[model samples]
Target: MRTKSEARKDAIMSVALEVFREVGFDAASMSQIAARVGGSKATLYNYFSSKEELLLEAMLHSAEQHAENVLQLLQTEGDFSQQLHSFVASLLTLVNAPETVEILRVAISVGGTTDVGRRFYESGTQHVWTEISSKLQEEIKKGSLRDVDADRMAMHLRCLCEAEMIRNLLGAHQRMSASEAREKADCIIDIFLHAYGSTR
Candidate 1:
């Protein structure tokens, strides 16, 4: 049920992401994105004010698409350990993908001088944290998890899950395989549950 304008914007962002990946962000131009999107530069400008804004929007769009499944996994009926494993595994798979790694590199490269980092955090990562925190709060209320600051707990869980994976993304190690991601997730979840489960 998207309006024409919304649909067009989505198309523009999708094309922009491709262009950004095909050419590094610093080399990408609005003109290139507009060309690929089948629109004039003026039309592209109507949707995005600048290349930075478009990059941020495109990154957010990609994150949202990847998060849809993770969010559902978090909310699914299951043991907390199993659910956490599923969520983290799915998240690692998405974040470790080459396209996502490329976008993240662009975000990091421009983070200091541009608002792209802030916008990316607020629009993408923050939303994921908020959703996970809410789910944690529900689990605490049900006595499956210990009573703790849900937001802080959620952040801690994310940090643990991303510890080595982030290094991998930064090229410290090879990208993790699905089995490796699940194994890592299981270990993190076990540690998390031991510390935060109701009995603890």
Candidate 2:
């Protein structure tokens, strides 16, 4: 069970995310977040020292929720292809959401100019990749996957799953529907299984 402090902190993050999404990171202020959170600026500061800190925590909170869903799918007992398809579909749906796209745009726009990008990568993307890589390592030990670097394999899988869709998203193309995401995920998993399925 979460302690009162932890629950309150989560509440603050929830409101902070809403405020950030409304005005974006650059334009968003701690006062704005505090207003939405129903607290004084001092109270908000007790939970998060700076807007940047709050932003990172809020982003991590969202990413962690999606990561948990994906990790659960990855750990499920099932056919490898089925599991891969589920994971890919979940990932694509999460990444293609309008809020997520906006967040990515904000991150990219400020990535080179601030440490926010690095923090986001380390806490969000790298963390998910690490978890997925560990699962791949388990499959390798079970002789169900090719004997390869788990980290590299995980990266390859993500790249394949997001390939054209990510490109189209960055290019301002129409967002993929749920059905299209599933179809693309299936195609990517098929190719991945073909290339990396155990030789034995």
lDDT per residue, candidate 2, 1-200, as tens digits? 89999999999988877777677788988888788878889998898778778888888888898788877998888787788788899888777777777777667766777787799899898999999899889889989899989988998988886666455447575676899889888888878878888989
TM of each candidate vs. truth: 0.91, 0.91
Best by TM-score: 1
- The residue pairs that clash in candidate 2, if any, are none
Tens digit of lDDT per residue, candidate 1, span 57-169?
Answer: 88888889888878999887768778878998888777677777777777877888899998899889899989999999999999999998999899888888667656755
Candidate 1, backbone clash total? 0
TM-score of candidate 1 relative to the true fold: 0.91
Which lDDT values do the candidates have, in the order given?
A: 0.84, 0.82
User: What's the lDDT for candidate 2?
Assistant: 0.82
What shift in Å separates residue 182 of candidate 2 from its native position after superposition? Answer: 1.1
Provide the RMSD of all predictions against the true structure, rounded to 1 decimal: 1.7, 1.9
